[model samples]
Target: MTKIRALSEADLPAVGEIYAHYVTATAATFDETPPGLQEWRAKAEGIARAGLPFLVAEVDGEVAGYAYVAQYRPKPAYRHTLEDTIYLAPGRTGRGLGRLLLGELIAKLSGTRARTLVAVIADSGDPASARLHTAFGFEEAGRLKAVGFKHGRWIDTVLLQLDLTK
Candidate 1:
């Protein structure tokens, strides 16, 4: 059975493995180099310490995915906005885990200082991600063409936002 729960500090190594796959296998993320496991752990720890939601999907003792929300910007004006990120294990895509995580995150974030959640997806045939966000009532707010470069090509970014206050 798959269980979803808060990500403890010890879960970062597994989370890093899931993130590493994207650096080499796909352009889902714009990160060209996967950080070391220690760095990744610290990142996760910081998110958790900030009172933000960082969750993991564990299936029978193995972490299948992780998701979290980060501050949209460093400005005080953006305090009520957050950007979401989700990464699944290499072979764990298409299992509806992303939906589960996103849904849980929305519920948790809605009660916090964040009033809006944004997902900036790489717009290159990534319908699964778009569909997941849409299922959570996130609407397409904007699209920036050629704003990101990965895998030797320019990739567009689709901005999807969910208004948690309403």
Candidate 2:
């Protein structure tokens, strides 16, 4: 059975490993280099300190995926808007883990002051991510063409948003 819960500091290593796979092997993230443990821990701590949700999905005591929400922008005017990030382990896709993690994150955000949730998918080829966001009520907001170059190919970012006030 898979379970979703708050991300703990002890989970950072596995979380970092899961993310490193995407950073190095896929266009899911535009990060050219995988962040180190210290950097990853700091990011998680900062997000938690800001009173946001950082979640993880564990299968039989192993971290299979993780998700979190962060302020859409640092400006005060954007306080009510949060952006989401979700990642699953390399062999963990197509098993509904991403959906579970994201669904729970969205549910948790609904109880907070955040009024909007944004998902900035890094590549147009990622239809599964787009479909997952859409299934959770996120709509296509815009698309930025060739906004990133990774692995010798130009990539497009698709923006999707979900209104929590509804």
Candidate 3:
């Protein structure tokens, strides 16, 4: 069985590992280097300071994925807007885990003050992530072409937004 729960202190290592896979193996994130546990801890701390939710998904006993949202920008004017992020463990895709995490993440965010949720998806020749966001009512807002270069190529990013006010 799969379970979704609040991120715990012990979960930091797993979270860092999950994100590292994308940093090193995919264009899903622009980070050329994997962030260490310290960075992940800082992020979790910052998210806590902002009164937001950070969650992890467990399949049986191992962490299978994670999903979280952060302020889209630091400006006070953008406080009501957030950016969504989701990543599954290696070999965990196409198994309904992404949808599970996203569904719970949205449910958790619905009670917050945020009005807009944005997704910045790297166009790494895969539409799965974009399709996942759209399936949850996110509409394509814009696209930036060749903005990120990695793996010997340039990547475009697709922006999708969902209105939480509705």
Model 2 lDDT-worst window of ten: 122-131
Q: Tens-digit lDDT track for model 2 on 24-75?
A: 9998899989999999889998998899999999999999999999999899
- Model 1 alpha-carbon miss at residue 34, Å: 0.3
User: Which consecutive 10 residues in model 1 have the weakest lDDT in total?
Assistant: 41-50
- Give per-model TM-scores: 0.96, 0.97, 0.98
Q: lDDT of all the models against the reference?
A: 0.89, 0.92, 0.92
Of candidates 3 and 2, the better by TM-score: 3
lDDT of 1 by residue, 1-166 (tens): 9999999877888988889998877889888898897887777777877789899999889999999998888798998899999988978899889988998888888669998899999987778899999988999999999988888899999999999899
lDDT string for model 3 (1-166, tens) is 8999989989999999999999999889999999898889999999989988899999998999999989999999999999988999999989998998888888988778999999999999889999999999999999999999999999999999999989
The candidates, ranked best first by TM-score, are 3, 2, 1
Model 2 clash pairs are none
Backbone collisions counted per model: 0, 0, 0
